[model samples]
Target: MAGLITILIDGITYASWLFIVALGLTLVFGVLKILNIAHGSFYALGAYAAASFVGWAASMKWAPGLSLVAMLLAAVAVAALVAPLTERGLLRFFYGRDEVLLVLVTYAMFLIMEDVTKLVWGANPYYVSEPYSLFGNVDVGKQSYVGYDFALVGLAAVVGSAVWWGLNRTRIGKIVTVVIHSSEIAASMGINVSRVYMGAFAVGIFLAAIGGAFTAPMISVQPGVSVGVIIVSFAVVIIGGLGSIEGAAVGALIVGLARSIAVHTAPVAELFSIYIVMAIVLMFRPEGLFQRIQARKI
Candidate 1:
């Protein structure tokens, strides 16, 4: 029973983090119809930014409780500063280009940002673990867990619900949905489709940034961190189905639990467990679990 509880907690905690990042990836694909390879760069950038901010706060002897706020602000700053610059300055020009070309462009951007991070932050791993323990701990049976981990689970739930509501219940969401269904039609109907695209992309950036920011305290913030995240995020979204928020959520849980089970049972399979599941799922449902087959206009 204790073992099962541990697995449940570990799986949920890990899934929360995956969902946060995967949500952004799926959102960008859903609205922009572009597979942004640079999304992971945004995640790395957010981690670096948060590390800098929270480190500065620590150096200034600010209240430790406020480190969480600093992390949030760091994410907001990245979203505000980098999102528009990337979307409008770079991606906008490639909008009508071949989708393959756009993917390559973002991949190039990701490579560039990797070096940019090293140039600005140096190659040293930044340790911002002080805030990780601020929330105290939770004791379950003979095991102990971090309160922050549970907090992440709650955060994921809130974020998932909020995104679902924003996309389904809000007016702007309706506009975005219309644009998603057909951008040309939305533009013909007097909607500023470009603006909608920009907004959705920016929101996606914000989510990616927050995922990194929150994760910074739990791990070393350093260069090359973005690669692994992007790889796994692709797995999650692919398993859950691209462009589906519900798919992202479900996919994250699936990956997280599968990984946890592998780690506890057969450590040798930990790395490949996610991919194995992905392969199995794809063999059955190539469009993913939540994606519908769109009738392409011939």
Candidate 2:
């Protein structure tokens, strides 16, 4: 019973951060129709930014709890500064091009960003462990867990609810939805489709950055971190159905649980467990669990 409880907690905690990252990836795909291969680079930027921000905060002798605010600010800064340059300066030119070409373009951007990160942060690893203990510890039956983990679960719920409400209940969200369905029609209707795309891309990058910022304390912030993150994030979005917010959530949960189970039971299978589940899901639903089959247009 204790072991089961531990697994559940571990799975939920892992799923929380993953859902945040995957949500951004799906949102970008849904609105912009661009599968951004550079999304993970933005995440790495956030982590590196967070390390700097939190370090600065500590040097200033700010309250320890404010490190959270510093982390949040790091994400916002990355989105605000980087999103426009990427979307308007580069991506906008490639609009309406072949999807394969877009993929290649983003892949090139990913490689460029990877090199840029190394140049800026160098080869050394950065650790932001100060924020990890802010919430202290919570005892769950026979096991004690970090309170920060529960906080992430709560944060994920809030982020998900906020995004859902914004999209379903707001005027701008309605306009964005129309753009998603048919950008040409939306533009004909006088909506600023370009602005909508920019906004969606910014929000998506923000989600990825925030995920990395908050997760920095949990692991070493270093080069090559983005590779694993992008891979797993792609798995989550693919399993949940690309562009579906709910799919990202469900997919994260499935991947989290599968990994947790593998880690606890057969440690040797930890790496393959996620891919195995993804392959099985793809076998039954090539379009993903949440995506519906669309009729082919000649």
Candidate whose TM-score is highest:
2
- Residue pairs clashing in model 1 are none
Pairs that collide, model 2: none
lDDT, model 1, position 190? 100
List residue ranges in candidate 1 displaced over 4 A. Answer: none
Candidate 1 per-residue lDDT over residues 1-298, each given as its tens digit = 9999988888889999889999999999999889999989999999999999998898899899999999999999999999889999999898868999999999999999999999999999998887889879999999999999999899899999999999999999999999998999999999999999899999999999999999998888888899999999999999999999999999999999988999999989987999999999999999999998888876
> Worst 10-residue stretch by lDDT in candidate 1?
289-298
What overall lDDT, based on C-alpha atoms, would model 2 receive against the true structure?
A: 0.95
Give the Å error, residue 155, model 1. Answer: 1.0
Q: List, residue by residue over 1-298, the lDDT tens digit for candidate 2.
A: 9989988999999999999999999999999999999999999999999999999999999999999999999999999999999999999999989899999999999999999999999999999999999999999897999999999999999999999999999998899899998999999999999999999999999999999999999999999999999999999999999999999999999999999999999989987999999999999999999999888857
Taking all chains together, the TM-score of candidate 2 against the true structure is 0.99
